[model samples]
Target: MKKRITASLASVLALSTLVACSQAPAGGGEVKSGGEKKEAPAEKVKLSVWHNFSGDDLRAKAVRAQIEKFQKDHPDIELDAQAIPPDGYRQRVKTVAAANEMPDVFFAHAGTGIKEYFDGGLLQPITPLVNKHPEWKNNFMEGALEALSFNNEVYAVPINASVTSLFFYNKSLFEKHGVAVPKTWDELMAAIKTFKEKGVTPISLGNKAAWLAQSSILSSLADRVTGTDWFLKAAKQDGAKFTDPEFVQALTYFKGLADAGAFQQGFNSLDNTQMEQYFIQGKAAMMIDGAWALTNMAATGTKEQLDQVEVTVLPSVPGGKGDPNSLSGGAGGGLAISKKLSGKKLEAAYELIYTVSGPEGMKAVAESNSVVNYKVDVDPTKVTSLFLKAYNLTKQVKFTPVYDAYLSSQGAEAINNGLQELLLGGKPEDIAKKLQDAQAKSLGK
Candidate 1:
């Protein structure tokens, strides 16, 4: 039940084993004094951790900063960390967990994504850890830990909030082309036409990984046509189905965008970073992406360039049952600790997790324009204008569902792969039927 996140981790910068220092070494028993067990002598220990903060971008720098601070805080502990790319990191975590060979800690998705680790006893509930730092736990936005919990026990701590469907348009380009911001389906098409005719890509997409179409665009676009109510019903296979006319119509509309050359050429072959570069270079007029992209812009683009961008949801579609001002969103994932240690070593792992994802950690990353699950107090003047715009919009807009966040992995895979085909001129009807079948099969269980 992995989420098809558009942004990928490049390398794990922090994670690994915490050699138990408080406990007797290896197989040694605790030293006894007169009539009681005396505490073991403290020794320098090595803690291993794994993460993927390979980039020097603001987000990565923020993460690295937290790690360094954690090391400094625990001078007696040496961190043995390994870096792994995003896709490889996901697979690696799975492989190790399935074999009961996980590191002391690692990064992963939440919600249904983390359920496997919890159910398999591969993870430890952090309720006690949070309890140990009540102030830190209280700083989380409402319901942030629910995504990383099972049976009311949280297993991980999420760092960011993922509002996945946003349209980031270059205001300068709109003014230069004399095109008004799109407000309806027709206006969107018209704007696309105007930009395409002007030799500019109307939208820049990086979908080589195939999850972008589902996560960034259709999640909200389809809601604009199908409404959140119908999507929930369809996902549950209760009173609605994806093959219904509304869903097919949504697919048709998504395909129309592709057919109109709304996206830059070879979008299906591009990754998000490349697409971000393409958009920042002004080769495209707009890019539909998630909230995390705010950090990318803050890290890579100049102040002037960011100031020319406006963050907002996609325009309304005609006859859409969804709120025109809504976006597809849900709680995002975070890092988890392995259930392989006890006593002081386990305590060290929990402390390390908090050091990297708690209040202080979140506040550090927020400087990079990250919209985190933790409530961070930042000077408005210090944040990038790009993030400020998106942050403000989140307050005004309702959050709709992000498909992969709720759908069964099979159902999500269906839509994700189907959209890739749909964009290449495949039949919308065919894709809708496939989606319905997958959802029905998944929910039937």
Candidate 2:
């Protein structure tokens, strides 16, 4: 998994070396001139941060408030923040890393995304920090800390956790067509057929944004059929082959949906925002998305829109390995400090993570209809039904696949691209073959 992500990030940042370069070792793990270690001065240091969620109105406001509060408490530390869109954030981070100008503190993913940076020696190990600070350790969610650790070293903090569920059908459309919410793949197909008969598209998908396709559909299907551990292992080729029955089943199911016209025309050109707009405006009957969509659905949807929407996990395939209740999700979205900053900068960085993911920050996240891994005392009244639903579903889900979690940089791109190709025109076995070939080549197997 690590190798796949490395390749993916490398391609994403091919032209931008600034962020990727900091990954290069300047000297040995020890200080030079060397009888004794040389320490850099730590007083009144300023650290820079880069994040993709910076411009999101509510998220931005929450982050800014946290920063302001942190600044007030730690007057000696200064932080500079830059926000970019999530789509372009990876390249920008790579540019900074390549140029050896990484932020002292920045937000990064916990899975393959951070593994590359950690392997490159560009991220600081936070295990000792978490160990020494018992308060931070005690408050984290179960399994949260373990997921963020690579090779026994903690490198990132989880700010939010999400499990991907299959969201489909407008209640109005379903009733109008007399179609029921599906509990199984066959039932879902029936529902799609009903929508098609009523001149409404069954499912709206935007694969133009590559990752969305994997996150929304492929990942969810993998969860339903293979369970999380196997899925993760498969992506890493961890004794699981691309040609495994579960992989074949997922590919076949995905293609069957496409062939049956489950999606609208020009799906290849559609992206997430457009897909969301299609569903929100009632142009489509259903969508497969994450819990984050709730905030948007509520904010932009009308009373009619609100009435028509419902959330649920994807239907199970007949005779699939995983239970219908098992879903896809992980402590994937989170924050981490860059290895670059120290002294006051380091202290300030930790403060930022603590504030956003801690009690006060988590409350804001819950209010925003998001999920986090904090165990702080909560006022149940403060959380929305969306979170409540997601929370319950997450507990039922015992696994998350490796394609999203374990594969290295290179593997992620190959698998995602392979899936896209299968959707476009490639055969399932051909797709699997390509994946096997790519893994063999990339991993030098």
lDDT tens string, model 2, 149-240?
78888877677665555465677777777888898999989888888888998998887867677777888786677766676566666778
Question: lDDT of model 2 at residue 350?
Answer: 72
- Best lDDT among the predictions, by candidate number: 1
Query: Residue 67 of model 1: what lDDT?
Result: 82
TM-score attained by model 1: 0.82
- Please write out the lDDT profile of model 1 over residues 283-400, one tens digit for every residue: 8999999987887776678877878889888999998999999878756677788887777778788888888888788887777777776667766877877787787777667778
CA lDDT of every candidate? 0.82, 0.71
Q: Which stretches of candidate 1 lie over 4 Å from their true place?
A: 1-40, 43-47, 76-78, 131-135, 197-199, 236-239, 298-302, 380-382, 439-445
* Every model: Cα RMSD to truth: 15.4, 17.2
The alpha-carbon deviation from the true structure for residue 148 of candidate 2, after best TM-score superposition, in angstroms, is: 1.8
Tell me how candidate 2 scores on lDDT. Answer: 0.71
